[model samples]
Target chain A: MSDQTYVTSDPRGSITQLATPSRLEYFFTAGTSLSKNLRGYQRGQFIGQRCPVCSKVYVPSRGSCPVDGVALTEEVELKNTGTVTTFCVVNVPFAGQSIKIPYIAGQILLDGANLSFMGLIQECELEEVRMGMRVEAVWVDKEDLVPSLASVKYFRPTGEPDAAYETYQEYL
Target chain B: MSESPEIFTSPHVLEFPYSRSTGPVIGSFLTALRDGVLIGIKGTGGKVIFPPTEYDPDTAEETSGIVNVGPGAVVTSWGWVNQPLKQHPLQHPFAWALIQPDGADTAMLHVVDAGSESAMATGMRVTAIFRPADERIGAMADLIAFVPEEAK
Candidate 1:
C-alpha cells in the first residue's frame, strides 16, 4: 500500500498527514440508581415505583417521578400483561440489532404501571401486533436468567381482547 | 426503596473515529517508522520525546528538532497481563511496558512479546520490531511488538 504511483503535487517536500482509525470503550456503573429494578428480573418480578403525588407507577423506575419531580419511594409490582401504547415494524439492519428483520417492537404500558417500556412483540404475525394489543412477558429459562430485562426474552400476545382506546387515550 | 438489586450491568460498545492531520512533526516520526527507523523530537531542556509530539507536554511550546534514537531501549516500568484478552495486542502472556528509548528521557507505552513473565524485567534491553515493509501502512501498528534484545 505504497504511494509510489499516486504522486501528489511537486515532490520537493510535501508533508501530508495520515489517518489513524481507532475505537474507545467505557463501562457505565449501574450503581444504586437502577439497582432495585435490575434485581427484580432475577425473581421474575416487575418492580416499579409509585408517585405519591400523582399515584402514577414507573416500571423499572429511574430515581424520580417524571411528572411530580419528586423522589419515588413506594415500590409496586406490575402484572405481566400490558397494552401496546405504540409500535413499529423494524425492517432495517443495524449494528447491535440481534432480531431478524420485520419484527415488532414497541412501548408496552404494563398493567398497573404508568410508564411505558419497550420490548419486542413476538408469537404473532407482524400485522397482528397493533397498538393497544394485549401482550405478556415471555421469560427465558429461569436457570440462565440474570437480574436484567433480558431475562424476559420478549413480549408475546396474551390472546386477550384489545382494550378500548379510551383506556389508553391519556397515554397517546 | 428497601428492595434494591445488588448490581446491574449492560453491554455497551463504543467507537471513536479520530480524523485529523498529524501535521509535520508527528507525520515525520510515523513516516520514519514506515521506513524501518525510529525517531524522536528534541523538546525543552534537551529532553527527547519518543513517538514525537507536536508540542512539549510540559512547556506547551513547539518542539525544536527531530533526533534519530533507539532502535534499542530499556524498560522503565511494566505490568504483566497473564490472561490475554482478544482485544489485546498479544494473544499470550505479555507485559504492557513503558520503555525509554536510548537518548530519550521519557517512556512510551507498548507491549513486549516475552514468552513468560520471568523473561521480563525493568532495565531489560528491548528494540522495536517493525512489520515487513510491504505489510506496513504508516501506523503505530507497523511496529509489531518489542522483544528482549537477546530474543531479537
Candidate 2:
C-alpha cells in the first residue's frame, strides 16, 4: 500500500477561492436550421430535408446536401415506427445523468426517413436490446415541454417483425 | 514499408467553463472564506470539512457549522511543478499539495514554497503565507503560498 499523500497551504491564514472567466464558441450557421428541425421532433413529429439534386432525404438535414453538396429544400414528415440499426449499453454513471446505469442508447431509422437518429431504449433488459428490433418514441409529460432533445423520453420496443440484416444494411 | 507521414501545428486555442452551482451550504462557506475567516462544515459522521462542501460525502446530506479551521496546516500530499501552466498561481517552480489545516477534518488544495520535490514530503508541517492586506482578494491567491515553519 502507498503511504504518500499530498498537501498545500494558503499564504493567508485561510484561502480565498478564485473564479475564472467562461469561454465562448461558435459553429457553422447551418446549425441553426438543424436545431429547428430537432425542436419539431420533440412535439412527437418526424421531419427531414429533401435533396434537390439526388432526391435523397436527410433527417436532421444539414446545410449542404451530402452527395451533391447542394442545399436541401422541401421539409417532409416521416413515420414514427422504425428499426433499431445499432446500439450500446451505458453501464457507467455520469455526474448529471437522470437515468440509472446499465441503460441502452441506440440509433433508429424511421420508416420513411432516409437518416437515423440516436435515442435511448428502455422497457426492456440490456441483453434483450438487439439490432433491427422495432421501436417507437416515448414522450415526456406535457408540462415538461421544451425546445430541446429531452422532449421525447426514450424508444421502447414495438414488438413488430424483426427487419432482415440486408433490408437496412446501408443505414448501418 | 510506406513512407511515414509528418504533421506540424502551432498551439491551438482551447476554452471551456468549469460551471459549478454552489449549493446553499457551500455558498455560505465561500462567503465566509471571502471575509478572511476559515470555516468548516461539521458532518454527521463527526468530521469537520474545511472549504465546506454542500453535501456530506458519507451521508450525502446538507452539512452545517461555521468552525474556524486554521491559522496553519500540514502538507498531506504534494507535487513539484517546475514548468507552470498559463493559469497556474505561480510562474516559477513550486509545490502543490492537499493540506490538512488545524481543526479541519478534510484537506484543501494550495501551493507551497518548497523549491523542489527533494525538499517536500508527506507530513511536512507548513504555515499559511498571506498576501499584502491591500492586495487581498476573495480567492485562494490571497494566501500567496504555504511556507515551511521554521525548525525549533
Candidate 3:
C-alpha cells in the first residue's frame, strides 16, 4: 500500500555497498594445563612445552608435537630473550590495526625454545629490526597482565649484537 | 602429564580483511534498501521473499518479478532482547521480529524498535524506519528498524 518502489533511477548512491559490520567473541576451554602455561606470561615468566621425543621447546605450547605426532607432555621454564629468525616490516594500515606504520612483526625463537612463534617488534626502527637480532619481551605492567600474549606488549632490541647467522640459520 | 594442570584460555579474535560482490538479484535488493525502498521477489506459488533472493527459497527455482512490500507490516513472531548486543540493529532494548510486510505473503526477519518488551506482540503493526536520508549508505542498515505503527 506504500509508494516505495523496487527501483530508483536516482544516481545518488553507490551500487556496491558495505554490509553491516559484525564481530565475534568466544573464549573456549583450552584445558587447565594450557591455561597454566599462558597464565605464566601474566606473572612475568615464560614457559614452553618440551617435546620428549625431540627435546624441542615450544612456547605457548601446541598441546602436542606437530612434528613428532605425539602428545608433548612436559613443561619447562623459558627465558624471555630470543633471536628474531625472520620478520616482515608492516607498512599497510588496517581497520583495527594497533601497530604504527613501518613496524616489524617477527618470528622469535626464545632462548630455550626450538619452535618459533610470531609477535610484534617495537621500540626500534624498522631498518634496525633484523634477522638474528637478539630481542627481549617488553611486557605490559604485571598489573595489566592477563593470561594472554597481550601481556607482552611487543619485543624490542636488547642491544646485544646480532647473533651469528650460523646460530639461527637453521630456523630460517 | 597425567594430572591436569591449569590450562588457560584467552580470547583470540581473528579479523580477516575481505570484500566481496553480491550477484545481481541480491545486489538489487541491497541497492533498494539504500534508496529507502523495500523490495521482494515473487517466488514459487506466488509467495514473496522479502530482502529478495536470486532463487526461490523452497524449490531453488529462478524467479523474476520484483515488488514493493513494506514501510508497514505486522509482526508474525517476536522475542525480546533484554540486553541488546553490538550486532543488534538497535543499541537499546528491542524485540527481534519476523515481520510480513504489507503486500507480501511471507515474513522476513528484522528488528522492531518498540521501547519495551511490554509494547511487542504477535500481529502487532510496525512501520519501517529508514536510516536518516543524508546518512544512508546502500546496505541493509539503510532500513534500520521498524517501530510500533501508531508511534510512527
Candidate 4:
C-alpha cells in the first residue's frame, strides 16, 4: 500500500494523514431477506421458520433455506434452553469491549434450533464451565428492554451432567 | 488567468456493509434502548454489563438475564484527542474515556466535557446527555454525548 499522507486539521503542520472515504451507504435493491422468522425470545417466546421443501426448522429464520435454496415460511417458537458446543476465553482486551478482561464468550445451540449463537458465560468460575455443558438464559430488566439480541444476559451452568458428545456433534 | 500544472492520482475507495444480525435476544434490548432506557445483561455470576451483550464474554453460552444499569457512569480510563479525526464525535479537542456507570461492571467508551487535557482525569465522573426525544435514534449517538458533572 502507498503510504501517501495528507494534513488533517492543520494546513501548515508537517504531519500528514491518510486520505480515505469519510462516509458510506448501502442500497439492497435486489431484494434481501432474513433466513428465519425472528421472535422476541426475552418475552418468553420462541421464533423460527420452516423450509417448505426440506421441512427443516430454523430459528431467527433466514430468507431462504440452505438445503433447497427456496424461500422459507411458517414461523415457529423454540425453547430458550440449549447446550454449549464450543467456546473461548477472552483474556486479551480490545477496543469497544465493555466488560473486564479474562471473560468467556461461547456458542450455544438453543433448544429446538439448528444453529448455534455466541454469548457470555457468568455466575460461576471460568474453570467450573466445560464443553457440552447445559446452560440457561438470563433476561435483562424489563425497564431496559429492547428488541435486539442483548436481551439474554449470560448463560450459567445448571449443574447438570455434560451433554453426550453424540447429542450435539453436528453442532460442532 | 494562466493555467497551472495539475497533479494526477488514482482515487482509491473502500466500503463495506456490516450485516449485523441482532438475534431475538439482543434485538429486544436495542429496541428497548431506542425507547429511552439503559439496559444491561446479567451474567450467570450476577455481574451486570452495559450495552447489553448477546453472550457472556467469558463462557460462550447464551444469556437471558437482564438488568437496568444506570442513568450515570464513572470515568475508568481516558485519553486526550487533541488532534481530532473525521469520524470522531467532536471536531474540537476532547477526551475519550471509559465510563463505568453505577451497578454496571463494564465501562462504555464516550467523550467527556473536559475542555483541555488538564481538566480530565481517570476517576472523574460524568453523565449521559440524552438526545432530544424527537432526535432519538437506535444507536450510541441516541445518548447524544456525555458531559462532565458540574462542580456541586
The pairs that clash in candidate 1 are: A36-B5
Task: Give the TM-score comparing model 2 with the true structure, all chains together.
Answer: 0.49
DockQ of 4: 0.02
Better of 1 and 2 by DockQ: 1
| Segments in model 2 whose C-alpha atoms lie over 4 Å from true places | A1-32, B1-140, B143-152
Task: Give DockQ for candidates 1 onward, in order.
Answer: 0.22, 0.06, 0.26, 0.02
Write down the worst ten-residue block by lDDT for model 1 chain B: B1-10
Candidate 3: stretches off by over 4 Å = A1-18, A69-73, A140-146, A158-161, B1-5, B11-37, B41-66, B69-152
Compose the digit string of candidate 4's lDDT tens values, residues B6-102. 2112234446433465554455454444555666776557667566676678876555566666667789999899899877788898888888877
lDDT (Cα, 0-100) at A18 in candidate 3: 44
Best by TM-score: 3
* Candidates sorted on DockQ, descending: 3, 1, 2, 4
Error of 2 at B15 (Å): 8.6
TM-score of model 1 (CA atoms): 0.58
Tens-digit lDDT string for candidate 1 (A49-125) = 89999999888788788788999888888888899999999999986678989898888889898878889888899
Question: Model 4 Cα displacement at B146 (Å)?
Answer: 38
**Model 1 segments more than 4 A misplaced:** A1-24, B1-13, B16-135, B143-152
- How well does candidate 2 score on lDDT at residue A150? 74
lDDT of 2 by residue, B1-152 (tens): 01112211123344653646444555455444455556677777668887777667889876655577776788999888989977789888988899888999888888988766777889988887666656655455666788777631
Q: Model 4 lDDT vs. the true structure? A: 0.66
